[model samples]
Target: MLRGPRRPLWLCLCLCLLLLLLLPGAPGHRGDAGPRNKKAGSGRPWPAFQGLQERLRAAGALSRRYWALFSCRVWPENCEEDEEALAGTLGLKSDLSVRLHGQHLAGELILRTVRGYLELPRPDKALVLSFHGWSGTGKNFVARMLAENLYRDGLRSDCVKVFIATFHFPHPKFVDLYKERLTGQIRETQERCRQTLFIFDEAEKLHPELLEALRPHLGRQAPENYKAQSLRTIFLFLSNLGSNIINEEVLNLLKAGWLREEITLEHLEPRLQAQIVESTDSAFGHSCLVKENLIDFFVPFLPLEYRHVRLCARDAFLSQELLYTEEALDEIAKMMVYVPKEEQLFSSQGCKSISQRINYFLP
Candidate 1:
């Protein structure tokens, strides 16, 4: 009886071993047969799959941008801030000398103030510049020039934060929310570097409340804890608040045969201040910056004449490495629509579109 029972048990054990060997996880099926069989149909090699995963992990764990924000490496090649580099940057690199016309005061004042600010061991106040001008008058250009001189990247620098009202804070109803976000961003960026540049473009469209939020950053007397942080930051506001008035004043001087050079900051600034306060947009009219003398410089960019437009055309052609005759350049300039019907010769829109227009004339 024991022999018969033992035979059945041994037979069952043998059958179990056979079943285990036939299953997917059987011993020989592991490394080569089982896993390789599954991936054998895949065209990509195994190393490529590993490489893809490694790249994704590297993008996350060792991201350069994340570290860069917190690191002093935010500024690269700071040698550009030297005096010689600064001179070459503003003098020959961009056509600030040639492009900026009828606004010598604005250029000289900006160069002086910016240079002085950079030279300071620890500036007492942040350099706040409010650029008031019509479109295409080089306010944005000047802002770029400032960044280019300060750093190698120009306006594209990580230290420079350009905020456009239309892009950043569009809705008037949600002005409060925008205010908080804007303030937070400024505060965080300022913490990174003392030489931070904050450019607010289309500032005329910025809600008064939103602009008010920046008052603390632009203040001459920053709070005790924030003094050092505030002085190193520069806030630049580019607006079209008094664009119409500026163009009219220039026309009047020209008609009176007043030398364009005769136009000075004293003649234009007061009028611009008054016009900005009286603007149709209530946001501009009730601006705290206007009420309080917080902004350091109220730089004005005069409208560009036909000659400036021609210069822009020449520059555009040169940039494209195409040499054109004077007649072709004149043809491109004539295509632009100018203002003050009596003086249609002068471009009201400036040289903003000349670069694109020159394309039609080029071979």
Candidate 2:
């Protein structure tokens, strides 16, 4: 009886194959073929497993968004806005205090003006700063400092634009063309960044037409309109137009035994403004920027003294990692001719050539 029943060969083969597929770790088992084959065999993943995968994908997306929000905090270079840079008053003040040797008035006024402008909730017009000084005074230096402290990229920032009159708008005949281009540039820059800086160097040479074109942007808008169309913009006008008056005033104050710290804006601003207004040789004098009172601050940079020059030389030496004796500093300071022969009071060229002067001491 035990040998009576005999299954067909095909039926026996099918049974053996089914047993192999069900057993774990067995040849031809579903575990050996992996989850993909199992899912393929079943047509779809289990409902719970599919939901878990979706949840994992969503969690990854959320982590990326969270990283983006705080990445700037960890690495300032990644910041979208320059608010932190603009708010760095202490760094700016320290740089001005230590490096900018001669011009106390310039250092103080610029720091205060820029800080106040940045602190505003909404400003009616762009901040306009007019820097008047001698050839070697700290006009350009201070401007660079402002750029460095206010922007991560400094002068190279996309938000910062520098226009030199002779270099940019060389021909008087091309005034209209310059105006259109400048207006377009301003509009485009403002559209791209909220806080923008425009530096017009050799401002005295700026054409009257160009200055007029800038009038609307620099002028105050009505409160209602200003809020809607507000752009945080800064305009810097660096010129040597009133350098003579500035030097004379500073010299007189020094001769009168007034401390350098004692001299303030009240002593210089009125005279410098008057000098710019009366002069006709430069377009800056008669431009509506002055007549309409759009130029906010007429900052004056006083002439540098012997001590200031020596300090500059020391700084240059340190910057280049060069060893210098006190006598070497004295020699460098002496190389620069001082004006008013009798008094020999001020350095003719501020610290403009100081970096080059240090080469003489090199081996």
- Pick by lDDT: which candidate is best? 2
How many pairs of residues collide in each model? 0, 0
**Clash count, predicted structure 2:** 0
How well is each residue in 1-363 modelled by candidate 2, as lDDT tens digits?
001123444544544454444446655233221112121225433433322222233233323323433344556685643344343454467578766887888998899999888877677889999999998788988889888766667788888899999999999999999999999998887877767889999999998899999987898888876654436889999999989998899889989999988999999988999999999899798999999889889999999888888878877876665555666778888999898898998888888889998888788
Residue 140 shift from truth in candidate 2, angstroms: 0.6
Q: Write the per-residue lDDT of candidate 1 for residues 1-363, one digit (tens) a residue.
A: 000111233444544454454446666332221112123225434432322322232232213212322222224454332332223233322234544554676877787787676667666667888898878778887887667655546677667889998998888899888988988888777776546888999988888788788777776653576654734677899998888888888788888887777788887888888888888775855777777877887887888777667666766775575655567667877888888787784576777777788778756
Local distance difference test, candidate 2: 0.76
lDDT of 1 at 174: 92
Structural similarity to truth (TM-score) of each candidate: 0.72, 0.76
Q: For model 2, which pairs clash?
A: none
lDDT of each: 0.65, 0.76
Model 1 CA deviation exceeding 4 Å by range:
1-95, 99-102, 227-231
